[model samples]
Target: MITEDNDPRKGKRPDPRLGSGEAPDLGGFTMEDGTVTFDWTQTRVRLARLADAGPVELGRRRRFFVARDDLAGVKLEFVPPLVQAIPSTCQSLDEYLNWLPEGLGRHLIVLIQAGASALGLWEEDRLVAHKAIKKYVVRGHGKAQPTYLRSKGKSRYGSRLRLRNARSLLVETSEKIHEWRNESGPFSRVFYSCPVRIWSGFLDGKPAPPLSKEDLVKIPLDVARPCFDELLRVRRRSLVGRVRTLGDEER
Candidate 1:
């Protein structure tokens, strides 16, 4: 059994093949019942991390992973780009999306700033992993805050950036740095276009209860809709009020 300190991919369900893909598999797991379970692999672990943070059990062995990455593993930061714009080397938004992995951020940065970058884990080279990471606004509706306040909003709504529902793994491992580098040009401008910091979390590659489609569909929208609706109302109300007040407030 590989310890967490030594093997970065330790406990990850290894595929019965090479990273390039081949056979005999690299990792396996053994159950308490002494039963043998095969066909389990690491690629699954990568996909699992994207959704949930936990160790996955591969084939049959004492195989398992520590659930959830430790705090030190996650790092978060913002970086603006050297150029005023991002060059996707492609034409349309769909072409860009099609060119990369899921959960990307071009549309997001375009709305927030001229350019930005995001760094996280990759499953078979996708922006997927154990600890989630991404960018968002300080308020539920604006760009990331210059500074986080005490979050005076109702306790029901804790922090605004968190509300965007983006999280990043902070672990400064080779993998973490690798992901950041891919997004460096657009993720930030802090380090000559490198990331100043990034949100990170330990990824033990352990498997946990899988998130069901029902759970994914209902939970977030239910939690976020209230505040989103309120922010929209606040903006509209402020806009209309500005029209009425400009004529008289000057006096």
Candidate 2:
């Protein structure tokens, strides 16, 4: 069902906060129309005592187990709102829309993986950085080739896009459609990467980091098929501290 032609971003669109701090220079990116803008505030939700500003739900939501069998959790829920998230070193594009929230100045065209939350960022008075998004891997790539049109004509270089379903019109395929006509790969996406950090403490605040089938043996795990482990029955907390930045320059 892949259809979004020309897609040089089809007409383009991005940047959203929804208030007044500024948001318009878009073909360059600097958005922050403001509705809840503190520019995604950044990690604070630990209040079981820090005087408690909110978000300390942590235990007692019950009925979720594994070695005992109860299961059933991920239908979606958890939409408190506020987001504008891009962070993998941010090479440029105007220092990543001046760090977004208004600077999404390139006419705001997100989805090279959240280009760091521009769509008005979750209006309600921004400052979102409540934290807990760990291990993000946004990723991006779209050089066509996954086609399905086969035919369409109009002329004058406008409408005539064909490539529809070629499962056997020949033979050899699927190296991601031979790297989408391989000029050396990635014909459209250009390039992208993600880290998106902000995680401070999880498994309790419930921001979705619970997987454990033994945490799938440390990392590269991808065997989905109803393997919904639910972090092996939830109870594993103890992060609360970690900063790392200097390019994650650890030792």
**Per-model TM against the reference:** 0.18, 0.17
Off by over 4 Å in 1: 1-133, 141-146, 150-175, 178-251
Best by lDDT: 1
Residues 62-100 of candidate 2: C-alpha lDDT, one tens digit per residue: 111111111321111111111223333445333433543
RMSD of 2: 21.2
The superposed Cα distance between candidate 2 and the true structure at residue 92, in angstroms, equals 31
**lDDT, model 2:** 0.20
